[model samples]
Target: MVAKSVTIDFEFDWGSRIKSDYAITHVTEKLLQVFKKYNSKGTFFISTETLPNSEKYIKMIKNAGHEIASHGHNHTLDYDVKSKMDLYNQIEKSKKLLEDIMGEKVIGFRTPAFKRSRYTDEVLEELGFIYDSSTTKSKMRNRYKPMQYANSKKLIYVSISTIRDRFPSGIKWMNLFGTKLTGKKPYIIYAHPFDFLSIKDILKLYDKNKIPIHVLLFYTARIGSMLNTLANCIENSQTIKNIILQKNEK
Candidate 1:
C-alpha cells in the first residue's frame, strides 16, 4: 500500500492580550500531549510577536521533532499598506528569526488570517520560501485570491482545505468518512491553540466576550472528539515541507 500524506498544522496566534486571560502555555502543552500520544508530527506556524513570550514552547515543539514555520513577523494584516521593502523584511525577518532559533531552514509560510496582497507571492519568492499555505478556497471571507496568483508556479500555493466561518470543514468531513474520502491529495488540517482550551475557563476570564461566540461554542463542544478523530485519520503524516520535497522529487 502507498503511504498516506497529510499535513497537520497549528497556528499559534495567542499574543499578550489573550495571555492575560488564558494560560497559553497550558493550552499548547495539552495539545502537544495529544499529538505526542499518537506519535504524530505537525508544523507549527508561529507569529514573530509571540516568539518573545513563547520561546520555551517553540523550542519544545522543535525538540519534539516537528517543523517550525513562519506565521509572519506580526499578527497584523497590513501587508498592503507597507512598501515592497517592508513586506520583504516582514517575511524574511521572521524566517531568519525562526531559523536562528531552530538552527534549520524555515521554508514555509502562512500569512496572518490567510489574507495576502498582490505583492505577497513576489515577496515570498524573493525570500526563498519553499511553499505558502496561506490561500483558502472558502467563499465566506475576503481571503487571498488563489486564482489570480496561479501564474506564479515557482512558489507552491498550499491552500487550506474546506475552511468555513473559521472552522476546518475538511476535518469534519474526514472525521465523518475516514481516509476513504482523503485520496492522494494532501489534506491540510489547520487549527489554533485556543481551539483546545476549556470553554468554562474562557467564560470565567471574559464573560464570553474575549472569543467569538461561534468559535467558542464550536471548539467547546467538539474539540476533544475532533482531536481524537484527527489523530486517527493522520496516517503516515508528514510536514508540509517534506510533502513538497517528495512532490518535487517525483
Candidate 2:
C-alpha cells in the first residue's frame, strides 16, 4: 500500500520579527481547507507559547480533523536553553500545556528554529515524544530549509526547506521535483502563514499606505502559484491513487 504522510509545525515566538495578522490567519484556514478537500490527514505542531489561552482555536482544529502536537512553550531554540535542566523544563512544560488544551496525549516534539544540541534529544526523550521533526537534511542552511529523515518512526525529521534547491540546469533534467521526488510519504512541510503570503505580509497590514504595489503583487502571485503546485501534487499521482484504492478495498 502507498503510505501517505503530511506534517505541519508552527514556530511562533515572542521575539520573532513577524507579527501575527489576518492574512496569516486566512492562509492557515485555507491550508486546512485544501487538505480537507483532498481527503488527506496531517499533523500540526503548534507552539504553546503562541496558542491563544482560550480553547476556541484548538477546538476548531480538532473539529477540522487534524492532529495537534506541541512545538514548545517559549519557542526557545534547544541550543539557546543554556543548560540541560532548562531544556527539560521548556519541553516538559510545553507538552503539559498542549496536552491540557487538546485533552489528548501529545507525542511529538519539534525543536525551535530547528536548532540542535545534545539537550534536544534528551529533552524529547524525557518528555516522551514519539517523534521529532526538526532536522534539515540538506547540506545548505538558510532561513528555512527542508529536512528529511530516512527513518519514519519516533523522532521523524522532515525537510524544512522553504524553496527547491537551486541546481544549475543540466541536460538530464526533465523531471518534476519537490516532495514527490523525495518520496510517497506525506511530506512534512512547515511555514508560517507569512511565508506563504510574502515577506511584507505583516508590514503591509501595519503600513498599507507605504507599501509598493509591485512587491505586493509579486508575493500574491507567488503564493497562488505555490498553492496550485501543491494542489496538483495532492490530486494526481500513482502513489495517491494507490492509497485511495487501498482504502476502498478495505
Alpha-carbon error at 198 in model 1, in Å? Answer: 0.9
The digit string of per-residue lDDT tens for model 1 on 1-250 reads 3333344334342333343424556576776776677776777887776667778888988888778889888666566566788878888888888888988888888877666777888998888888888776654455444333444678887766553334333554444445343222565766566544555665665573475666466556554565666667565656787777777899
Q: Write the per-residue lDDT of candidate 2 for residues 1-250, one digit (tens) a residue.
A: 3354344555441223333434335567776677778876666667666657324555666678777776666755444445888778777877887788777888766667666565676667667776676765444446334442233444534333322443111101101244433432433444444444544553555374344566455445454355554554443222222333465598
lDDT of each: 0.65, 0.53
Question: How high is each candidate's TM-score?
Answer: 0.79, 0.68
Q: TM-score for model 1? A: 0.79
Which residue runs of candidate 1 sit more than 4 Å off their true CA positions? Answer: 1-23, 80-82, 141-145, 148-150, 163-184, 212-215, 221-224
Give the runs in model 2 whose Cα sits over 4 Å from its true position.
Answer: 11-15, 21-24, 76-81, 141-179, 183-186, 198-203, 206-221, 235-250
